[model samples]
Target: METIQAIYDFLQTRTWLQVNDPEEQIVFLAAGEYNENYLITVEEIYGTARHVFRINHGSQLGLANQIEYEFAVLRALARSGVTPRPYYCEPDPGFDELGNGVLLMEYLPGRPLDYAKDWREAASIFAAVHAQPVDDRLIPQPDPVRDIARECEGLIGRYPDHPMTEARDRLLRYRERVLETADEFQTLTADDKPVMANTEVNSHNFLIDDETGRGWLVDWEKCVVTSRFQDLGHFLVPTTTLWKTDFEFGREGRRDFVAAYLELCRAKAGSGMDLETALRCTEIMERTILLRAISWCYMAHYEYTQDGRALRNEDTFARIEQYLDRMAWFFESKT
Candidate 1:
């Protein structure tokens, strides 16, 4: 409720919603440190009105960086023609200096998209997103390998004290391997173009239609100017477990996704990235992800095995081990 009040007070003061009005019909939606989103319907002396506000409670990141990233995502989505309709975004200083930060925009109305029914459709959506020309104007440059390496090292340093020391150590070593692999790989993918690459493309990031095959990607917080292969890899690898489920597209889905991506890259040659370069990018992306997966395994193992929690989740460890093996095989096959 504190968060809701924060949003209300923040909004009330803005000229958009005259602070002195007592007849405002404001409604509470959702709030979090990431950002507080609200759907408000107000009635004036004349008629009814509606507004969707994104109260930017971006305490998790620096104010400037948070605001810039949000704006960038909106811009990228607008450019790609793949995002929900956004009416307005409250700019920085939209809230009290220390109390709150928010971004106001239109609220999209629709049921969440189902991943099982639309993995390929989702991949194609990303293909379309990547199809757009890379905007050098949006997002800062990133050193994927180095940044990931540093994260792996951080995990390694904590291994001694971590409950899943063994798994964490494996992850640490894997990270080192990936960095080494990237160093020897000469034909890495690089582009100075604008990209709508979303780093976190998990199942939860999408909203699906049960009747139609259409999907919309959400939470563009981590959208960056990274390789398109990285986006595809995120979609394919994390959900690799789908191979075991009834879901038709786990491993097979990933393969098809990769194929589709390669085809798209080939089709858009002069645009920037092509098939061969995307494959190399895929390798780099996989190396980075495998390290993270191994770390996740470490985290899960420690949390479960050591704490005596998730005892029934041994199957998870086995699955993780299989994932690692496949990654190892992938490395050897490419080499």
Candidate 2:
């Protein structure tokens, strides 16, 4: 109740919202590990309006301007029509009610993407979202595969040292296989264009509009400057899809998705992305994204188990356990 009132109180501070004269509301939408979302509705002078009030826990990017950075990225991608338009940002910490920080953006109309129906829309969404130009504001990852492996090593370093010794050793062995094949595919494409990659592209992060059937990608908390291949590869990999869903695409379906992505990438004239070379870079990401996924589960599972995160999802913990149990199934070398 206090949190909701705080949101309304914050709105009252905003002259544009006119909280007193308007039929205003702030309802809790959802809460994730890093942030809590609320749907803000108001009857403004123009018309009924809605936006998401995203309250941050802290800096996931390890930068001072984390919220501002996300707002900026959203603003840049707003023109692309694939992301939400950022409305306001309160990056300064220690406000009356908004803890850490908060940002407001257009409340996108849609539901969590359904793999069976929304696959093609997802491909187009990723293509258009990645087509947006990249800049230095986002964290630059020149060698994404190596970077992923390094992060895995870090995440794994936490376990087997304690209660998860077996899981740790198991993940470590599979990670070695991932690391060995890391260099097999060319990391850098011919064009060498760095994309504004949404590192976390799970099905839940994507939304499909009911009426228009348009795709919308949300949750840019893990946004980075990396190869678009990394984004596409993560979306294709089972480790990602299996997180919130059990619907797995067959080999032919994957081939079709990649073809659509390639075609869509080529179609976006303003994206400045090279289709042929990017396809090559994407190939490298396929083999490496798993390593990151495994290590992430191991680390996050441990963290969530130990009450490391503020918001804990038992469903996520169960899936992490499943992934850890079958490390080979997810990451085994195909050759």
Candidate 3:
């Protein structure tokens, strides 16, 4: 209640608009993987217009900067009409007691894309997002493969010992493969150009407007400037399989999605992206995405076990095993 009141009080301080029943208007929405989301509806005193506030509480350490960067990204994409409008953002000092950071943005009214029916739209939306020009200062331009390799190295160092020997062995093997693949991928796309890539391309991150049928990509915290294929692989591979079973695409669906993306690229006259090279990059990045997933499991396991949250150990190990199984399946299918 105090936190809610604090948010309400903070909202009242803003000079842009007047709050309409701040106490009663604030409603808790779904909590995301990294942040708690709240909806605040306010009415303008000068008119009959009502604006919804998407208040996001970013509690993680490094996420405060991510929230700020997301604001910048949204601002850059404002003219593109594919992202929610960012209104305000505050770092840790502003909401020290409640969260590490807070971001208030326009509440987009839409539902998550239904992958089976919306894959083509999803591809088009991503292509449009990637095509937008962004200030290089706000978005990081890191080598995707080297970045994943660093993450693997960090996870190994952070968790020197694993509770489950089998899990540890799997992680070690996965890291080795990732490093080798990264080397090859670097050689394969040495001259590849970077684009505005959403490092996290899950289905839930995309919201399709019910009225316009246009897709809006939300949750820009993981947005970066990288190879377009990195985003493409993440979207078409793990993301499709993770959330909805109905959205899982077989060979035909995958082909159609790729076709749509390529067609859009051609229509937009995308520079530095060729069909042959992009296809090759996609194939390599799919394996990189698998390794990235495994790295996430390792990080989660380390955090869960080290934070005195042993109760979640079983679930964490289960997730690691599942990712390993997926990785093995991927390799087997490729062979």
Local distance difference test, each candidate:
0.56, 0.76, 0.66
TM-score of each: 0.68, 0.89, 0.84
**Model 3 lDDT tens row, 1-335:** 66567677776776645666766777666555456567776655565443334344442224446667777778877776778887777655365434555677777778887787888888888778877886686646457877866766666566666665565576567667666766667776777657777777777788888798888888777777777888888886653356434355666666677778988977886555555656666767776776667666656756665654312436436656565556567544433
Candidate 2 per-residue lDDT, tens place, 1-335, comes to 77777777776676535455322477788877778898878787789988898988766566667778888788778877888888888876356557678888889988998887888898898888877777677788877767787777878895654577777887777667666645544334545567788888888898888998787899987788877788888887788777888877776777777778878877875354455554555555766787778777778777776744666767778887898888778755422
Worst 10 residues of 3 by lDDT: 52-61
Q: In each prediction, how many residue pairs overlap at the backbone (N, C-alpha, C within less than 3 A)?
A: 11, 1, 0
Global Cα lDDT for candidate 2? 0.76
The superposed Cα distance between candidate 3 and the true structure at residue 29, in angstroms, equals: 1.7
Candidate 2 vs candidate 3, TM-score winner? 2
Rank candidates, TM-score, best first.
Answer: 2, 3, 1
